[model samples]
Target: MLHVLFFCLCLRQVNGEFVDDEVKSVMEGDSVTLNSGLTEVIDEDLALWRFGAENTLIAVINVIVGSVTVYDDVLDERFRDRLKLDHQTGSLTITNISTLHTGEYQLQTNSVRKSFSVSVYASLSTPKISRDCSSTSSSSSSCSLLCSAVNVGHVTLSWYKGNSLLSSISVSDLSISLSLPLEVEYQDKNTYSCVINNPIRNRTTHLNNTQLCPPCPECGHCCDVTEAVIRLVISALVGVATVVVLAYDIRPRKDE
Candidate 1:
């Protein structure tokens, strides 16, 4: 049995380093377990878990003693009440993890040190489509579009036309909103969409020029604009005709 377990652990390593799963994604406010899988832990055998590049200490466990100690100096309120250490398996569990918790983690024992990556993403927020006309007060034929996702974390925002990717932005932050603009032409009929996604799930909003942005009218007024334009044109024509008639009738007795 010991030989079998040893072989399995050896297979999990390359050269001399223990290679972790490429990346594990967990939704925010959820839980995950990082298994150590080390057996026959003895006294004086210490297991350590650390996070980030500098390897800020998180927790330490004594196998034979079956005791867990967290490094409060390094892991303040952020990890309190949410971190768990299992003495039997040397596994670490995190509950209610936020986007701030996304990073690479390291586990070290006397025998081997292993590394794994974790990415925590928030619940997907719906992308919002809003008009970005040249004139905000009135409609304009030249209107772009803005798609936004509010206060999302560790995700990507992208604009697509059919299957072709137009543009995309990635956010590593856990608490900020982001927007992407599409320079759409007037009466654009192509199927365009704004999608916000994490590795696990995504949200999308379809573009509609008619719904969010309508064509600008000749007049700025929303109500009776067409009628007002017609009346103004007629008045200008009538005034021009009167001037022309006067000029013709006066010719020198005329036109002064």
Candidate 2:
């Protein structure tokens, strides 16, 4: 548990030789520059950036002589011709963000002698679902939910139903088309969400929800669980805020 907590902290880091995932509202086909603070790398120093979902580094962007060189680790053969890097500017660019491109990216760099690490997040293309989807007869068997991430030379996929983790598969990116069987009842009106997460970036998509209808007989119990989950989430947020506030309040002023 302590190790897991430490890993989570490492993933959520913001500054001081660290990169935080900023909640940016970006549209498609926009180029955004991710700066690694000029302070971290002085002028004339070499810097590099590598991106991946887990232990392996999928793509690399090398910087030298005020230029960048990109090397892509071809996990899927399809990405061989698709991925490109700007050697002149040290910018990593993907031609078109597809549903498969959403994953965590690891940025590793060096400043003269010392090495530093950072993370970048990419989001999945969220195709909106019609709000007027009024079909309770639709069962889970009609659709599928899948979340995927690259982990240590393999991609891990997990399927879920509401809060229950149903099935998972670990395979090479070339074999990532596996599917899981599901059966959603008409009463299961909950929106099924696929939260694909890695150390760098995380993407979430709502697969589907049986159309809203009259309350189920177990509506009261479901409501109780929903309320409980909400309270737990809120309490966790409040606790984190309290810790931050208290830590800042007690820190000595640098001017002193």
Candidate 3:
């Protein structure tokens, strides 16, 4: 009869109402700890941890049985060798985490039930700036440019003119490319920069107007010079050929 009462109490604790979920954000390759919020678990208490929408069991601690299990082998080994459980508090720590680990985590204990929403973001890559050569024209005074980043996700690619934001583009998919375009005068001396950022971190690349958006080449003068050089070479070759022909005819005709 006493054992049955203890089992009933355990069931009530396990089925307790869960509190509001807490949100957590972490960078990729960093460690995050999902605190169980329990100071110390009693010997008669049971602590359980689950992950994802499927409620897959990832960890469990039954102090009464003196057993602690971490199911890191499940989920296609994604959590393999990465899960750590604090036996005292029933907290879970995921080391060297990636975006694949972003999900919902639940912890149930005899004292309280808690939920956490973990979001793992990839590190921001530096934005690259290049001239839009296709948009270049001798008559156009403005220089068209593109700033891009590859294999980035959950980031905003933005163009900033000094302290003001000029334009921006955002993406949420994984391992995708992002590009933002800006046009500025070739002689403009204003500071410009391209930035790629997430909620936690950002990367910035400054623009070098003189180097990237130099004044358009003088195509007309270049073509004219090239044409003149070609004509001069052709004329010289023709004159040489005529002189050789005349010398051969004048000197060799008598011998024939």
Best-performing candidate as measured by lDDT: 3
- How high is the CA lDDT of each candidate model? 0.75, 0.43, 0.82
Give model 1's TM-score versus the native structure. Answer: 0.62
- Per-residue accuracy of model 2 over 85-166 as CA lDDT, tens digit each: 5444434445433334444444445532221232223333332222222233355434322233332222344555677876
User: Model 2: residues >4 Å from true position, as ranges?
Assistant: 1-17, 23-46, 58-68, 111-256
> For model 2, where is the 10-residue window of minimal lDDT?
1-10
Alpha-carbon lDDT of model 1: 0.75
TM-scores of all predicted structures: 0.62, 0.31, 0.77
Best candidate (score: TM-score): 3
Clashes of 1: 2
Please provide, for model 3 over 1-256, each residue's C-alpha lDDT reduced to its tens digit, 9 standing for 90 to 100. Answer: 0010010011222345537567777888888887777778874378989999999999999898889999998999999999999988888999988889999898888667778888888877799998766575545777688899999988999999999999999987876788888888768889999999888788999998568575435655788899999999999999999999999889877887
* Candidate 1 C-alpha RMSD relative to the actual structure: 9.3
Tens-digit per-residue lDDT, 92-183, candidate 1: 88888876788978888887567768777678889987765443543345466778889887789999999799999998776578988777
**In what order do the candidates fall by TM-score, top score first?**
3, 1, 2
CA RMSD of all predictions: 9.3, 26.4, 9.2
